[model samples]
Target: MSDSIDSPIIIDLPYEEGGKKYDEDIFARALQTETHQKTGQVESSNVTEYHLRILLHYPAVYVIHAEESHSQRSEPEYCVYVGETNDISQRTYEHLYNDPQNRDDWRLFNNHGNMSQYVITHPYFNKSLTLDIENQLMLYMSSVDHVSLPVNKRVNPQRDYYTHDRFKRIFSDIWLDLHRKNPSLFPAEGIILDSALFKASPFHKLSDEQLEAENIILSEIFAALHLESPDQIATDKTNPADSHLILVQGAAGTGKTVLLSHLFYRLLTQTLPEEDAPLIHSPASAWKSDDKHQDGDHASQRNLIPKEDISAYILVNHDEQIHVYNQIATKLGLQNRSGTVVLKPTEFLNRHSRKNDRHRALLNEPIDKADVLLVDEAHLLLTQGNRAYSGKSQLFDLLNRAKVVVAVFDPNQILQSSQRLSPKIQKLLSPADDSAANPSNNGNDDEPSRIQLDDYNNAKPLTVDVSHIRLQQQFRIDASPEVIAWLDAFTDEGIIGELPADCHEHAWHADDSVDTRSKPYDIRVFDSPVDLFDAIKKKAEIKADGCDGKGLSRLLATYDWEYTSKHKNANDPSGHWNVELHQDGTGTWRMGLGGGDGTDNTSHDRCFCQPWNYQLTDPHSHRKGLNKDQAWAEKPYTINEVGSTYTIQGFDLNYAGVIIGPSVQYQDGKVMFHPENSKNKNATNSRKDLGDFAEENLKDELNVLLKRGVHGLYLFAVNPQLQQRLMDVYEASKND
Candidate 1:
């Protein structure tokens, strides 16, 4: 193994060769066992010096799976396992002979005849790099539709390494090779990358900002909980606050969900950094770069971690996103062990909060406490009572129960009045700034702005030390800075400005269509809703770069059309709640196409209409098998339907076809929000005591709709004024 050998070596183990698990001499033995190339005679040989030299002799990572020949599946599915080892030969022998005596999972590979393994070895593979690769494989394989269940659960996601920069390219090359060998077992990297579980997996490497945030947050948690600290970490100073609330404020697609997922996994799997700790007990992943060995073999040193009972949970409000987080929890063996790690805000409230709790627990009073509570989409937390949750405020209730509440918050994403943060609380989450630019508290990535609130939500009073941390980078909407500025201007300032001269823009004509020709992004505006839908269908059929199958494209809209999770009435027995729009013969804008004057949006009209999401049946539904819950955009059937903020919040689309409904209109000077035109009671409903947030809520609705596309954004406005304004902007940009 040498640095010159940059490419990964993929070795496939045959099912069996005379009761042996692997063909160490694969190329030579295959030619001998089946037919000699020179002699046309059947023979076998188990000797090859060249194959032996590279056959898992060095450090490597490996994956093995079993496929039943008589299994009742349209496509192949397998029970997969991913592992890493320094001595691959010994590890293989142990799995086949010894490990089966203790573990049932290994027994499958031991006895099953249809088992095959693709061993991955590289010259740069070391203890930490191989472990990280193994963890990534576990995460990716578990999310694959073809993988039924996983046998290996050792999730060791390493921190920065000497060759960490090369990990992404190396792992991709290895995966591509494996896919070529068994396309069914190993789906294309694109399909896996687009999955919700993969997006939320803990194995995702952190950006510099994310890494800084992670370290600071972890330090905060340790300080708050008074956990044992190593010598290098400062722990002499202690804050006497009863509870700590860390507010992670960022716009959409700033890696908030992934950051929370990674933290949750760390809280469950890790202890604290120590010297000479074994694999599962060490925080060596977070070791400093200065501590690395001169030869880049720092992993050889064993640093153990102290074990602690750090009860942690991550709560989200959405129905589909909960499924993604829960699936990640299950695959990594983080749930159903001691207690659940992923939960809804309401379920957690009921389970943790005492029914008799009317006042907050007094200082130093006996209170039920959890180590850490991570809240994703904290803006979606209920600010008022509902039938489902009787609490006055979900955020306040969570703070009363947990030692530290780390919530991913963005006031702009607060969709409904029930989830809106009042002016009083606004001061606490205010002044969101880039952590990278304004580092505070001894020059770490923590925000300089901090507010100490003594009493929060009088109904459940508690002392909370609130801090705001902002993530400014845009991870979604793969467009230029000018493109992002244009979108922000429209949503935040209500101005549709011209695009940049070099903006990554594309328009589809009969001759020009979507393809995977390595474009940075594609932004287009359609005058007709039908044309937008057609282009979306075309984009869905075309794969993006590094993908093997069709891309993910969905029709989205503002909350203008009427829709519900239930059936409308006996007249519409099909329960196909649709977003219908058309012209009233004079080409005047008309909604709900067929029932004459277009007053009722749910009229029985099929023309110029498509069902809202969760309304249509996709012939390819069986192939997707959405596990009874999926992100609205992830399903194949949803392409025939339209989605809104509820189903698509905290999600991304490869290409988004957003129908900007009439509720969002361009008025005298700028974008005007008309709640009267909206059918969403949540957005238009009168706030009981919290002031009117309709304008802000609808503004967020439009902002969210416009930002869903990662590779592209396709838009059409139902409002004539808004439509005309957008066309004007598009035309003005053409000259540049």
Candidate 2:
């Protein structure tokens, strides 16, 4: 054949002619046939040049074409729909079997369903490509259907109803109904609606009447439930008359904190005196009000009310969260001797001194008069201890006394076995009782029953009986419609959308040495602790350079090292890392404070140590010399603080490098195989037992280490075996 003839001829065939010539058989054969180039599949007769262009440019697109013949006496036997998908097989299954969400469309073609034929075009063949293909396919199909209408004819009323705006409005209405009637069925406590569905709906622009109606309806709903309106709950307002416990649940970035702040403001300002009166009735009075104490001075002096009048807003969490909140409060001028009280369980206990028994007794008295109690991380508050002595009753007692309490919880981040509470708590927070325990239970009566509140005889229960509200809007990023849709799909499908659009451009430049230029999204992984140490040193260097060698402020180095303790041979080389010392050799590790004299004579052992002067080794003691006692052994194991990841959770740093020591592993489908295990296995055997003793330690280690970074995270697993385990977790989480 001539070169000109060999080149496939491009034709602008009519839809009918194209359909007749390229049936299912021809299309299938073409897809399977070997092409001349051996790289590309043979061109199918059913696919058009337009579709081919789309496929070639956008490898994620799938093109489907069909034709049907209509008899004058009956309806058409076939209807075609074009769509793209990451998984062709799944999309095909849904269209052919699983009815599309819009039942009206399905009903229109139900009579001719048997005559329908389906063809799928695969974009990518990798396992990861499945979801992407399916998503793209859905988008393409919807888009094609949108533009396929006859231009000259009047628009279909049904089509108008399915418009992006209309879809969003309908979905919003459905969500509102579901949220009102069956609130607990939705995840994230229904605070998160389908962003895509919302965009497709027509409810975004509420008319003045609609807005007023919505507010009134919402107010009535809250009123009927004897709960504060969502607006009132979010604003910083206090209802001295109504003592109801409010549960505000939602994912991050849903204005929870902002709403809480507003509520605080309302609570603070609403109680101001209505008017200020002068001491004297008139100017003619010879003896006027004490002019020395002018209104301006009075106003200035009385700007802040007495601590007793202010509602006690308590934010509870583990030690770390409390520490972070304290720091934030201090910076925001919200902290005062009585206005803000920061207390850990140990700190609360320590306040009871043996010498000041009377003060200690008063300190432990019930907080029955507290006006308001806000628990920021309520999930962390529920965790139990091994014994009653270490239990959280102190915190529980305080919570029970408050007139109003607000809490936030994320079920997915449950960190401890004890943290998991009874269904009673879940029921109280959930909007409805149906499916509150398990939506997948199929209403099985034979299933094990839940423990009733009455079962706990010794303890007085803390009941949160008020109505619930869920915040659905996310204001974290300025995302495009496409990006929002993609995120929504990921959340719906239970897939981890790594490199989400918010973090898309967060990579660091390979040549950029300055830490200031580094992005937060960069994934930094190292095989050894030395590498992590080097990364930290680099950041320190950048800080030093930025400060013109004046030395960085608030920069500290903390490690799991014991030689740095205050009680250790003060003469030992690494004795500057400890924060406190008791008569015993044990001491606490100070997370911040390092850099000191080369001889290590600093009063505060935890003072900052220069990088060049610091050494990761123990030196032989001289006077009162190296105590050979096992407790005082100068061995490496005794020198470093082992497994202290919990000390730094809920904290942020300019940069952080986590070094995964060798004493960790994953074996026999369980995370174990550690030397510590061999010595501690006798402690417990049950999953809960092991989890209580080990899992929290490991998770705390990871959580604290991960959270330390404000701009960057550098992870280094010292052991290759442990590195692999960490990698497996990262990969598995990504897949999820």
Q: For this target, which candidate reaches the highest TM-score against the unseen true structure?
A: 1
Q: Give the whole-model CA lDDT for all candidates, comma-separated.
A: 0.69, 0.34
- Candidate 2 regions exceeding 4 Å error are 1-266, 269-310, 317-367, 382-395, 410-459, 466-520, 540-572, 576-647, 662-693, 707-710, 724-736
Q: What is the C-alpha lDDT profile of model 2 across 69-128, one tens digit per residue?
A: 434312222233333344333444444444434444433433443333322222222222
Report the C-alpha lDDT of model 1 over 274-334, residue by residue, as the tens digit: 4333322223344321211122333323443333467889999988788888777765557
Where is model 2 poorest over a 10-residue stretch in terms of lDDT? 149-158
- Clashing residue pairs in all predictions, respectively, total 5, 40
Candidates' TM-scores? Answer: 0.81, 0.39
